[model samples]
Structure formats: C-alpha cells, structure tokens
Target: MPNTIVELRDVAIYQRESLVLSEINLDINKGEFVYLIGKTGSGKSSFMKTLYGDLPLTQGSGTVTDFDLRALKEKDIPFLRRKLGIVFQDFNLLPDRTINDNLLFVLKATGWKDKEEMDAKIEEVLGRVGMKTKGFKFPHQLSGGEQQRVAIARALLNDPELILADEPTGNLDPQTSVEVMKVLQEINRNGRTILMATHDYALLLKFPSKTLKCDGSKVFEVVQKNV
Candidate 1:
C-alpha cells in the first residue's frame, strides 16, 4: 500500500500559456479526506482539472493514482480517470437518462460487460448511498441532494481510489448540504481519499479536515491541523 496516492512535487499548471498554479507540492495519502477551500479564480478548479488530467502540465512532475500525469498519454487518460471519482456543485446527470442507465453507461464505458455484474454493482453503490429507491427516478424528479447523491454513486461506479469534488454542495439548502456531506463522509470512511473544493465555511467548521487554500498563485495548508 502506498502512503501517497497523489503526489505533486514542484508541479506547475497553465491554461493557454498562462500560469495558474506554480510549484504546487502535495502528497495526499490513501483513505484521507481533505477539504480543498479557495476563492474563485484562485485555481481551485484549475487544480482539480490538473488532478483529473483536464489541463496539460506546463512544468514540474505530477503523479495521480500511480500514473505520471506529466507524461500521460492520450490513450492513458481514460485509464487514469478510471481511478478517480469527481463530483461537482452542479449535478451533471444526463437529462435523457435514468439514474440506473447513467450508472450503466459508465460501467459499459469502463469495460463492465455482464449485465448481472453491472446490475449488482449499480444496486450495491446506490444502496450504499441511500438512493437505491431513487435509482429509477430521473434527475429532475429528485431533490438537489438526491441528485448529488446519484452523482456520487456514478463517481463510485468505477471503484475510484480518489475523489476530486468542486463545490459539491454549493447549490443545495443547508440541511441538504449537511446531508450530502454525511454521504461523502460515509464514502470516505470506506477507504477513498477525497479532495473537495468548496466555498462553504460553515460545513468546513462543522466537518473540519486537512484544509488547503489556493491564492496568490500559491497553494498551502491553512493551519497545522491540515498537516
């Protein structure tokens, strides 16, 4: 077992030749839940993008889930992402698809062939997230929290080692936000490392963890607690 599942040593990221994150050094271990908090345009999303291989590395070395991000091939991008689960503030469910279909789509894309196995996997994850009943429901029918839970189930479909969430509760109500956080916490308890970017300070204080703040083209810990 590796102590560090995500290692970013002296890594730099750029968009359109403009630097976004410079010299970011991070060593995130397995089974850790890290709260990634930062202001907008402070490279929170950009950093997440880098972790998921959406942005090309302009400088330095990076490795996510044992794959060299700086040296990642186009064909390997999909494989790299298979080890990562991402959640966003906005629920990105397919409007035309049911919850079960959405999960099935991901399974098929990731090489899950047997319908029985796929059905069992889908049922298992949805049950774990407390949305097994809502699996037949459409995205629009569920509440914001329910939809986000489905999104979480989708992210877990590939059995990802890490989760990179960007403001996952920004659009939900207070009670619902806390509920979603509980579900995320439950997932983290099951040995998945989660790095979530959020603007919700109340939730941060309520469920404090290793906090990283991105500002002034730098990313660092907020306190010794983060260490």
Candidate 2:
C-alpha cells in the first residue's frame, strides 16, 4: 500500500470570496515527486495555499501531512507547517543573515534547542543540497541559484514529511534552473515527498512526473505527455 502524504476529497479552494477550485480530489503518496502546473489565475496558488493552511478549506475535507485542513486553527497552523517544508520562487532568505544563521533561525523557531544537535542538522541539510561550505555567505553574496540552494537546505532543517515548493525555479536562467532542479531531485531520491507548483513547461519535459494541472477552477491529473 502506498503511504499517502496528502489526500483531498471533495475539497474546494477559495481566495477571499472567490472560489478558485471546486470538487477537488487528489492524493500524493509518500516518496513521490508530483508537479502542479497551470497558467496564472488558474487556481494553482490557491490550491497550494489551501494545503499549507494559508487559505482555509471552507467547503470540503482535506488533510496534508495528517493535519486536518478544515479543522486547522490559526494557532495550529505553525505546528502543521512544521511538518511540511515550503520553498518560494524568489528564495525568501533574509538579507541580513548568513546561510547558516538563516537555517538556524528556522530551527530555533521550530523549537530545536540543542546547540550541538542544531549545528549537526544544519551541516546535514546543507550537505544534502551541496551547500555545506557556503553557509558563511549572506544571501546577496551568493548567486540566484546558490541562494535557492540555501533555501532548500533551510527547508530540510525540520525533516518535513512533505515539501511544498511554489515556483522554486521561477527566477532562474535555464542552466541555473536545472542546477537547482538537480538538488531537488536529489532530495526526492532520498525518500522525501515533494509537491512542486510551476509553470515551466520546459521543466515538465525534462523531468516529467505525475502532474496535476489546475484549469477552469478544477484540478486534475494530466498524462505526462500532455503536460
């Protein structure tokens, strides 16, 4: 049996008063690398927000990493988020902090208190993304790709069960995008489940997987060739 990490049934996604997606049913099993693809205003962001508790599931039932989306309280959001890792398009790193400090901040916020254990985890995640030696540099000191690698490392600090990457490579050049993609792929190969939202069709062709496309206020799986 497949270990399901994300499961949504009869789910409706909303942004404010507008309904973005309706009657959605989806499942993402553990150890799978799934892609969410769609044009702008096609409900992809809304869907992801609903999963991460940024938007509430007002009209259906859903669960991400075992937290009930519908019953997820504002206070419980932080706890839910700890079980999942999120990556953003622009590499949301603090300009004032070095890569190690940025990652340390996350660990501290998530209740990791041991100095030696935190240091070991920081090194481990950075090593996973091949950013082990770049931890001393600030975000502005690194290139776009390198900053994103640090972001990925930061996401892994909690050892999340599911990773939600929202347009992770949207700001990179083609070659740089591939370099970042390779890091993500390496993470997935090591048994992490990843759900990435992207509009880059070129990446779809290069690293095809189970893809879900948001269209016309509905989310459905598309065959790899169609993607």
Candidate 3:
C-alpha cells in the first residue's frame, strides 16, 4: 500500500469552546493531491489547524507526517512543521525583505546555517516554482500570482512530506488563480502530496482529485462528480 502522509480516524476538531467537526476519518497517501471544500465557517480552518499542530487534537486519533497529533507538544510543533509545509491565503512574506531574503530567513530560522548550501537550496526551489529570476524582487514588486509562487517556493524549502494550502488562490484574480493552480498542479505531479482547502469550485471542475467536504459538523469524502 502507498504510505499515508495524513491519517485521522474518528477525529474531532474544535475552535475554543465549541466543536467544529466530528467523526472525521481521512487518509491521504503519499503523492496524492486532495481538495478540501466547504462553505464559510464550515470547520475547514479548524481542521487545517488541527493538522498543523495549532489546535490540539483532544478526541479521536490522528497522525501527520509520522507525528501523533494527540500527543504533539509545544516544543514538537517546530519539528512537525519541518515535515509539513503550510500555505495561507495571505502570502505572509515580509514586506521589508526581498523574495530571496524572505526565503533565506525561513531557512535560517529552521536551522540552516551554511550560506552556500542555503543559496543552492533556494535556487532549486525558486526554479521549481518558475521564480528563479525574481528572487531579488521585493514582495510588493511582484504580482499576486508571483507572490503566491514565492510563497509556494518557501513552503518547498524543507522538502516537506505534505503541504497544507489554505485558500491559496483566494486573493488572486481568476486568471492569476489559474496560474497558481497550475504551479500547484505541477508540484503535485512531481510527487509532492498536497491538501488544499478552497471554496473555488471552478478549480475543482478543472482539476479534480480525491475531494473531502466539511459540512454539518462532519468531514467526509465525496466523489468528484457530485462536487
């Protein structure tokens, strides 16, 4: 069987005092590209937070990139993050830094100290996302699509086992969204497992995969045709 990157069985997700999702059972294997779709306030963010060690997993059982969600500790969060990459709706790049500097900052923060090695790794990732020539440009210098590409490049720095993208294209225009989607699709095709949470149904129809839906306090898999 293929190796599972994310597995949750009978899981429950919460936001502060209230429960948001219950009875969640999911299996995302290596090299799979899955889509997470739900309406606003439908526990999508809560579910993503649970996976990334933001919200504690208090009920059921779950594992992400070999880390037990139920047993994850504050100190362990950084290590867990190294094994997984997270992309948010906002680019989150430091506005004061150039794209290359932004990526370098993450590498240093993650304990990469060798300048030559870091530079080589940065080049590799930027090339993968079609932004090798634009690394010196500031965040504001690039368009939304380019900024998102840089964000994706930043996520790839650690060679993560899984990538969690939350509304990655939510801020871009329709055409720019397609560009970002194509970049993501290319990454998936190259064997990186990705779970993207989005409300963009048009993208669903354009590039369908194993889809999961969060609705009515539950998370379940849905066939692409029905989505």
TM-scores, all candidates, are: 0.97, 0.98, 0.98
Task: Give the runs in model 1 whose Cα sits over 4 Å from its true position.
Answer: 224-227
Ranking by lDDT: 3, 2, 1
Inter-residue clash pairs, candidate 2: none
Write the residue-wise lDDT of candidate 1 on 92-181 in tens digits: 999898999999999999999999999999999999889999888889999999999999988998899999888999999999999999
lDDT of 1 at 200: 88
Task: Compute the lDDT of residue 199 as modeled in candidate 1.
Answer: 86
In model 3, which regions exceed 4 Å deviation?
none
| Clashing residue pair totals per candidate (backbone < 3 A) | 0, 0, 0
Model 1 clashes, total count: 0
Provide the overall lDDT of each model, using Cα atoms, as 2-decimal numbers.
Answer: 0.89, 0.91, 0.95
